[model samples]
Target: MSELGKKIATRESYGNALVELGKEHEDLIVLDADLAGATKTGIFKKAFPERHWDIGIAEANMTGIAAGLATCGKVPFISSFAMFAAGRNYEQVRNSIGYPHLNVKIGATHAGISVGEDGATHQCLEDLALMRAIPGMVVLNPADDVEARAAVHAAYDHVGPVYLRFGRLAVPVFNDEATYRFEIGKGIVLKEGKDVSVFATGLCVNEAREAEKLLAADGIDAEIINIHTIKPLDEKLVLASAAKTGKVVTIEEHSVIGGLGSAVCDILSEKQPTKVMKIGINDVFGESGPALELIQKYGLDAQSIYEKVKAFVKQN
Candidate 1:
């Protein structure tokens, strides 16, 4: 069955995981910057009203409070829009939570241009780059519902600061239920091939897999890698894949700069030399539209990836 027929999104899975977290840890505190409903933290608030905190519409203050809660031995999973969480709480995340190395988990939803119809104001195409730039922050971009649920637990278990970015739209779960497992810093190799290595994160990973299928039909062998963890980048696996493929196409919903594209190129530059074609939102603010249309307009959709892979296979 196609994953889309399953009808589940990573954001909804996060809501389910937060409820489980509150049940498991009495020290678990759920905080939202007035976006609990939209960010899917409303499920946590509904399940555990006492443990869930509505910190108004202030993202910065929410970060500060999460830091304070962390200092008191509480695991604060803060929720909000990715733009507000990453752009607004950047300094607080860098100095207070990260510099102090606190166990503060940030579950920022509505990441990427997937914040459809919300336009440039609410859409966050650069949040991944911003969060990944932090020194001690553990950056995550789960591919779908299964990985999103796993990431919640993974973030809960990790000792220091963690940032998880999830989409506002529904997507099919790409995780292989039997053998797949989520690790804090480990990447998943979903499909094995040598023609082109497509390393992708978040919802884009699903698109990359779809693109891989199309590439295979066109007599191309593409490796589809689910790079769930972006901060502690899996350089060894990526370098090995790049070395084997010689040609790479990085897919992300966020900007190419300082995001997955840059990270992959960094790995290739150090351990191997691979020709990388970066596919993502290229330094452009997203406009209000349907999510799929916005994806195509921004050149971050599966078709764009297919074309890039086709062009790359011809050259390399």
Candidate 2:
């Protein structure tokens, strides 16, 4: 949690990081499809007006422009809502960015079901699956403000097409910059236990931590792992934890169909077979409601995770 006892949205950290990065990297350019204010890219735009480009509301064109800028030795960070950046411009992103392996960073904000009152039209639940399917695309989902700030720097340092997912909701700041180190393709173990391993990403990571506490009270030691990177997952760490626990549980704000749950299942099934349980949206679209209430209704809350894990641990 933050020292001030207030939650901060990852998108806010991203906007602040971009301004700092702009001061250091002269070649860094930011592009937005007329959503600078909503996506928080307005902060970067204010800092670097000369380097920022507002390409109107055309997402596909904005992607192409970013790709062109990348080809000319410029590191372009394109910002938009997740639905527009990853959903509306999928084909352009696939061919213009992913296929060419361009050095473009897609800063997709308002991801998952946490975009309160926006309904399914604005909330993006399939971005992880969509981005993960692209070859050579590095997918990053930050769990807190600190991780989000670090992920922005990591994406800039990496020399390939990267998809950086951010959420609109303010989540708990669980990581300390002094001790916590963010690495691409690495999973951090927040807590260690013996009964079951809980793998989580993005907004669900904080909830998983709460679930860890609940499980501890019940004499169930649950190991909690924050999987910030969805692509090129930390297979070694996951396998090691699963080997010790023998049971696995995955939680994400996205759908269970092709999100973190699917990714973990694929790894466990291939390398070491383990009983796995998934807690997330069960192939249903989101409706307009309060973000916290929607999370509880969809069984993505900490209590729901604890109950599901208890059942899974008992059965397995």
Q: Which candidate achieves the best TM-score against the true structure?
A: 2
* Candidate 2 Cα lDDT to native: 0.93
lDDT of 2 by residue, 106-163 (tens): 9999998999899989888899999999999999999999999999999999999999
TM-score per candidate:
0.96, 0.98
How well is each residue in 1-316 modelled by candidate 1, as lDDT tens digits? 2243475767888899898878888999999988888888899989899998998988889899999989999999998888888888789888888889999999889988988999998888888788888788899999877788889999999999999998889988656555568998788888999888888999888888888888889999999999999989998888888889888888999888889999888878877888889888878788999988888888767788898889988993
Identify the runs in model 2 with alpha carbons over 4 angstroms from their true place.
1-5
Off by over 4 Å in 1: 1-4
Report every candidate's CA lDDT. Answer: 0.87, 0.93
Model 2 worst lDDT run, 10 consecutive residues: 1-10
Question: What value does the lDDT take at residue 22 in candidate 2?
Answer: 96
